[model samples]
Target: MKEKATLIVVGTPTKILDSYEKQHAPFTKYKFHLSKVYKGDGEEGTEIELLQDGNKDASYNVHPLMEVGEKYILFLERSSTGALIMVGGPAAKYKYNKEEKVFESIDGGRIDEHLERK
Candidate 1:
């Protein structure tokens, strides 16, 4: 099934917690500082967290670690608590290629193609 994404933005990751030593918890998390608003109400420079970790075997849906200072286009949804987060695991995250002026999917293409009607 296709997951619904309500928000889309270009932002930079401020921090990440994939190991137990960092967040003091078992789940992996990413904190992003929004830079560009694309499809949601996220304000520029505001921070949001993306959480999606459970156990060692649950890595299939996990988002890869984002590099600090690297801008990315994020497809997101609001959680019940009203926090912004990745809408469909790795499928919702894309890296912004500054020189190319395009959002490159983690799987190596533009997300627009997959999102459009065929």
Candidate 2:
């Protein structure tokens, strides 16, 4: 079985974000690698840079990518019934170049699609 967090987001729900947080009060932030982003479409959306530690929001690039800090990431919460509810969709995944501080996506591999198909 997969590990359970306080909340989780499956498929992708644009409207369900606020409700999920309201349900998980004192909302905490959970950061993931940001494998992908879906613009409510089946095709893979733009990829955001990944940071070892960063916020998922804040808008740095011209593209709608989440910032890397701590507060912007999504948090997962578990319900009283012991089911995991999705808190939020996280930032897109970018490669972490040790030498370079900037976060950027790799040449042509997408992670979100891989996860979805799985």
Candidate 3:
């Protein structure tokens, strides 16, 4: 049940902030500058926020991918409030090198194909 995901997007993380929910539970919010939409609406130029539960003790397997200004291929799941959050923790995150045109997985594997560009 860890690998469940529905949407994928390639974008640069522009900003991040730590915030709390109603009961003071911490969560991280990431704002992304979308470049390529791989599985959802292919609209670019819009910024979107991805939120993840930050309480490690009872988190939804949320891992930190908080490198602002870095490009990433992110696997996400939509919340009831229309926000997107990382899915499957670190496994759903991939660093994208625009210079070399490659996607590097969290486990250090280079993924060059099986992802639709544009």
Which candidate should be chosen as best, given lDDT against the real structure? 3
Q: List ranges where model 1 is wrong by over 4 Å.
A: 1-3, 17-26, 52-63, 80-83, 111-118
lDDT of 1 by residue, 15-103 (tens): 77453332443445678888777666678879877764442433443455556788777778877867565776677777777666666
Which of 1 and 3 is the better model by TM-score? 3
Model 1 clash pairs are none
In terms of lDDT, model 3 sits at: 0.69
Best by TM-score: 3
Worst 10 residues of 3 by lDDT: 55-64
Error of 3 at 108 (Å): 2.3
Q: Model 2: per-residue lDDT, tens digit, 1-118?
A: 0133332222222121211133323222323333233222222332221122222333224223333331122234445554332332233333333354333332332233223310
Instruction: Tell me how many residue pairs clash in candidate 1.
Output: 0
- TM-score of each candidate structure, all chains considered together: 0.65, 0.21, 0.69
- Candidates 2 and 3 compared: the better one by TM-score is 3
Model 2 spans > 4 angstroms off: 1-10, 16-24, 27-78, 81-83, 86-110, 116-118
Give the per-residue lDDT of model 3 (tens digit) for 1-118.
Answer: 1236666778888887555564666677877888877676646778888876663344443355457898887788877777787776666777876787888765665665356432
Q: Tell me the whole-model lDDT of each prediction, alpha carbons only.
A: 0.64, 0.29, 0.69
Model 1 per-residue lDDT at 44 = 80
